[model samples]
Target: MEHDLPPVLSLDIGGTKLAAGVVTFDGLIHGWQITPTRREEGPRPVLARLFDLGRKAVAEAGLPEVAAVGISCGGPLDTATGVLECPPHLPGWIDVPVGPMASEAFGVPYALENDATAAALGEFRYGAGRGTSTMLYLTISTGVGGGSVIGGRLHRGAAGNGGELGHVMVRPGGRRCSCGRLGCLEAYASGTSIAERAREALAAGRASSLSAVELPTAEDVSLAAAAGDPLATEIWDETTWALGSALTDLVNAFEPELVVLGGGVTRSGAMLLDPVRAAVARDAMPPAARAARIEPARLGAGVGVVGAGAVAHDLLLSGKSDA
Candidate 1:
């Protein structure tokens, strides 16, 4: 059935970039293209460019025609209605009819999904999570976002935003989250938060290698911590602690077989993975800890494109879209 499915055009809309590719059922991407988002230009022009990029991808892939188009972006969104509802990353983009617009552009059926939820499906079907029935995926990038696959199916909670794992409370009444909540995981564990914390520390006159950099980022903090900078180490340690604490709770609650960590910040590799793994092993219930194997995502920078493609494939297989 998978072999018979036609290739689909996949589009990923992010705060910083836009990517497009034609993805086959085998999860191989072709004619991949990318460009800066320039989000300040607002939704209309950005969407126009996205559509053009999709056309270019289709033309370059040299396929007869795509079966469908899949769009993946940050949420809160209405999957059933194909509308984006004020996603934080895309400011001033409210109630955008993306699904129908994409359908009109490509003249094919379209399926829209939350970016993290789509990435979870991508990993489950084609990447690190293959063959696992229950898995959790966390993207620790500009903002922390997550999704899960339970019993081999994507779990898009009643809100259709997956579980919003990033919003899990880690430190009650601590740092404020973008979601207006205090001490949510995103407030402490996200790349944005990591950089912000380091900058705050430097601003308070704490001395460290980070002081040399004009604008220290999460990567800078990780590097400084690895080199034994005390301030950076403290910040890095706290970052891992928050992630570990939240993951321990999730592991106990979901009892997943795998936990995949993806996104830019995860590029620190062992620096991030080692401590998080150790914490889960030490704090989570024995059974849950033993069952969950924490690993890095394998799809790399193209995950969003692949994930969007996976969503389109599912849409076709479901027979809900005439494409």
Candidate 2:
């Protein structure tokens, strides 16, 4: 069972939380840790704590040494230099040299990747997209983001973020998005948007099961709909409809072999997937729909860490080749 391949340390930075773990070649995590990001305190403190958590993971995993480190964060970031450049999700996080910091902290090389890109790699290497040549990944959480595997390798795009699928227009000039755009798909299909829309509806005195709750999250809305609330059902159906519409366009353009959906909202299970699948089948070009299978991500909550680990390992492998 002994081989020369060493385990990699992976870290995922989000607006809400920071996660770190030691990941092996077999797509397993050794020591995993997650905690809130507390972004109001700004980058220096949060990043210092994140690196500290990485050290703790390395120790808890009982690995003698880490081969490299991989990091995943929201874009617009510089994967080439491992710098985070003003991600709107992480307010005030600008020009942070995360890669160099991680490398120096761990005394090993590191790779910084867009979180969506990392998720795509995770799904491609070990999850729903494993057998496919070209696949797209969408994570629908605090925001909607995307990445893809094209020609059998992860696509890094011109800016390294690759295809920003979530930004695709589903409704032209509709709701305003955090990205300052109008009617983008993320403005409709993401968990944040779902909850926001529901809250707005309820605040306007719409009657529903969720109206009784002081704050109704997306989960509340989904549960309310499942329990047969008319208003909640309407909102839930609209969410699925928007997702299907955007995905129909994506399927036509990418013609990927598979589409993987991840993040918290997908936990609604078939409520989210079934309709989107049917929509793609009905609306997308028949050839493209036939070519792609829309499915859920298999790695679940650990995808970001696993993905960052994979990115780190790949970067190390590439560096060795360059040497």
Clashing pairs in 1: none
Each candidate structure's TM-score, on Cα atoms with residue i matched to residue i, is: 0.99, 0.96
lDDT of 2: 0.90
Q: Which candidate number has the best TM-score?
A: 1
Model 2, span 79-130: residue lDDT tens = 8888999998888888999989998998898889999999899889888988
Provide the clashing-pair count of each candidate structure.
0, 0
- lDDT string for model 1 (247-319, tens) is 9999999999999999999999999999999999999999999999999999999899999999999999889
In candidate 1, what residue range of length 10 has the lowest lDDT sum?
1-10
State, as a TM-score between 0 and 1, how close model 1 is to the true structure: 0.99
